[model samples]
Target: MGIDELREWQAFDSVNPIGNYRTDLNFAVLAQQIARWSGHCTEIPSLKDLLVIDPLPLTNEQRAIETAKADAARSQAYTQSLIATLQSRVKRK
Candidate 1:
């Protein structure tokens, strides 16, 4: 009963507008609802999904920079592990 009533209310509100007809919030909601209705889609893509799109293929220079960053990170991790092992050995002595 609740879901049915909510759907009916949404149907009515879609045409009527929920608040001051020309207000920004009302327009934004109306626009989103219209997009969903027109697209025959129930779920809107999340803001993160919309904004954080897959990056374009990297140029060779960009790929090299990324590779360098990854290599530096691995080297740092290895150094930290070595230092930890040495510290443990020193503590035992």
Candidate 2:
């Protein structure tokens, strides 16, 4: 069941005044099991589906900004790797 349905079930369970019984324990167990299974129930869209859903047509300025950000990230990663390599060489010496 979805999160909403699970919440509804929980609400009903909270107000249920049948006293502490085996059925309550059973329901709790069932709710736990359902919670575990809920992760699998979520629908993750594929790449093709995402493209169709949100065809992000960025403007030239926006594209330029994104490209600059990516370039900065690449440069940062390269600098980090170089630092790591130098540190390893020092350790080996």
Candidate 3:
């Protein structure tokens, strides 16, 4: 595919090839354009335009998962500290 075809593919703003219906076809089209761009494309699009350097905001589900992981880590640390205190008291007795 050429630059003209690539531009044509990118013309639609709401045409995300991910997280939508028609999974197989969407991925195939996205892959084809990316391969063409990477293989022999001069003057690539900027990072801002691609939204790679500055990523999209996380959804509520993602934020909840991160919070749960952090909570589990803190709980494990507190449990370990309590066990160490109990062992030290037994030794003293």
Candidate 4:
């Protein structure tokens, strides 16, 4: 009964944005529901199906640059997430 009501309510809500969608609802859960309703898909890939092979050789300087780039990218990704978190905090108030 609960799921049926949720589905019916959501059908109307999708057309006209009417409810309070709280942050208590997880993003992953929202994404899954959206994907299902929109007829798209979210896939979890298996490790055996994935293959990454790097055949190119690099010099010492080039290797250092690549390593630095990877580290910088990791830092940048975290910084972006931090900024988004701060922005969301500002929005909620």
Candidate 5:
């Protein structure tokens, strides 16, 4: 399953407390039900197979560069608009 589904299961398990019964039978029964519904023999997945990593972590320099590029693009767009306005005024004259 995906990371989100695993997280949701973990959250549900944490809140739903299973008290100790004979030979931990309550937990076992719950596990079986979950397995049957999920179509997996084991309710839990191996972490090695399911681990997710964030692909993008920007350094301060990289962040600054991106901010500067965005600012430059906005400035270029504004300049283009001003030029268009001036050309329109010239045409009116």
Candidate 6:
């Protein structure tokens, strides 16, 4: 979980009743986002704006998954950088 979600959980767990749906959802989403970010999962829309997927490792099937994820992350960074540079040059001209 990110800082935001952790704090929210601590606060709610300490005092609140059993069913605060709003806070629960916010924390859940944050946790999911953090998990996805760590895994370099491209399905997360929020972090897509912030991160690129590094290709997942390919040592074994599991490692390969990680290598592919890392590669994808790097690829995303590369593609985005290329586009940004091209756009900047076009603008300058």
Best by lDDT: 1
Candidate 3 shows a clash count of: 0
- Weakest 10 consecutive residues, lDDT, candidate 1? 46-55
Where model 3 places Cα greater than 4 Å from the true spot, the runs are 1-56
Candidate 2 lDDT, tens digit per residue, 1-93? 999998998898788634455455555556556656778636543443323223377899998999999999999999999999999999999
**Stretches of candidate 5 exceeding 4 Å from the true structure:** 1-55
List of clashing residue pairs for candidate 3: none
lDDT string, candidate 4, 3-68, tens digits: 999999899888855633333234445555665677655664332223232236689999999999
What candidate 2 gets wrong by more than 4 Å, as runs, is 1-54
Q: Name the better of 4 and 5 by TM-score.
A: 5
lDDT: worst 10-residue window of model 2? 45-54
Clashing pairs in 5: none
Q: Candidate 6 regions off by >4 Å? A: 1-59
lDDT of 2: 0.70
- The TM-score measured for candidate 2 stands at 0.43
- lDDT per residue for candidate 5 within 5-89, as digits (tens), equals 9999889768854343333554555655665688755456433223232225689999899889999999999999999999999
Error of 3 at 45 (Å): 37
Candidates' C-alpha lDDT: 0.72, 0.70, 0.68, 0.67, 0.68, 0.70
lDDT of 6 by residue, 15-60 (tens): 8645564555566667677867698766765532333332232348
Q: Which ten residues in a row have the lowest lDDT in candidate 6?
A: 48-57
Which residue pairs clash within candidate 2? none
Indicate whether candidate 1 or candidate 4 has the larger TM-score.
Answer: 1
> Per-residue lDDT tens digits of candidate 1, residues 38-88?
987678743333332232567899989998999999999999999999999
Off-target runs (Cα >4 Å) in candidate 4 are 1-54
lDDT of 5 at 21: 32
TM-score of each: 0.41, 0.43, 0.40, 0.40, 0.41, 0.37
